[model samples]
Target: MEETMSTRRRQFKADARQLLDRNFRFYLLLFLPIFIIMIVTAVPQWMNGAGVDNPGYNLLSLLSIISGLLTVGVSFVLIDLQRGVAELTEPVSKSFTIFNRGAYLWGAFALEIITSVFTILWSVLLLVPGIIKGLAYSQAIYIYRDYLDQGHKIGFLEAITLSRKMMDGHKWEYFVMQLSFIGWGIACVLIIPIIWVVPYMNQTMANFYVNLAAQEDESDEEPTVVSPVDDADQSTTESKPETPADGDEKTADNDDKTE
Candidate 1:
């Protein structure tokens, strides 16, 4: 089924619920440390006039790279965990897992740098174009996995291109979906222990990727069509008949003369 924003959110909740049913503590632990780090990272923004003011480009850049790497890391883990396809669950702590994944961790950081720089440059000229481009390039990580699995040789620009293509008609819906989380995010920051919001948001985005990827997969697949001309029965019926035997032909002639 094609998912709307609300339906995709519901689907993620349902998936999260099913996952919780397996091992709530395990899944909770999957997010706890990262949540703590998020809080830690939030401190500076809170100190800087609650993020209304800038904290200079250097600190912000480092934080962006680290945050982006961590985000992609957690996302990679959660997606694998959701499908029960990865052995990454052993680490339990997502912070450690992010780096432990080796190439995955560094690769995400690399992607983050390129995507962020490009998106920021795009935004420098115009805000709307930047936001649109931001949303467009946002799916690169998810698409990265797809390209790797499908044997598509994906470099930075190719990934961004594919992500943009996947997001062509769905950016507004996704933007609205992210906007819907604003209140919950605020509530979580206020309450602190309501850390479930992070994973929920991440999972929702992951689910969104799954939905979008499924749509792309469907689009790429050509429907199997059965042509009557190609059917075995139809071909047999249309085949040329065999010639009559000599004796049988003479008997038919005699019978016809008598008639």
Candidate 2:
């Protein structure tokens, strides 16, 4: 039976929860640096809330960029961990390994900028369309990673286009999947809970991508079809008996005469 979108979403979350239950401590440690980066970035914005010109704003902006780039790494790590390809022992190093590859580091940065601009542009027209576009492009980073895996480097625009294609019928399901995390989002207001919630949400999103990619791959494959005429021909060829040679016929005739 074909699984419904709701069923798949539930399964993704369930799998993520099960994985987390087994390795919550490790996952938390993995995501702790990102949480700290986010908190540090937010501090300047909070300080600037009064509209006063804060000198730290420039530094905060730099930190924000760093955070965003590191987030791409974190996403890669979580996705790898979800797919069972990443080691659990060196979570921090694995997360930073994105920086080791210039192509991935820059490609991820470019993709982030492109997707954000496009989403913001759509949002400028209306809130719903922007939200929908955001959901549609949510898988751009994952798609980029896939391209890297296949040794086919693609531009940020192309990656976004592929993500939009991959997400054609899944925007609502993805939206709802994110919406279901409202409770966790609320709990993160306490600050410390963010370490737990961040990894959980990232892992669940990774599961979502894994399932969606598998479905897309299945759909892309063409099934082999056998024609009835061809089947009949093959069956006849297999069932037909071999004709006897002249020697055999002569021997049979001789045997009959002798009998």
Question: What is candidate 1's lDDT per residue for 11-40, written digit by digit as tens?
Answer: 766786565556556656776655556666
CA lDDT for candidate 1: 0.61
Best-matching candidate per TM-score: 2
What TM-score fits each model? 0.68, 0.77
TM-score of 1: 0.68
Best by lDDT: 2
Residue pairs with colliding backbones in model 2 are none
Residue 185 in model 1: lDDT: 77
Q: What range of 10 consecutive residues in model 2 has the weakest lDDT sum?
A: 250-259
Model 2: lDDT to the true structure: 0.69
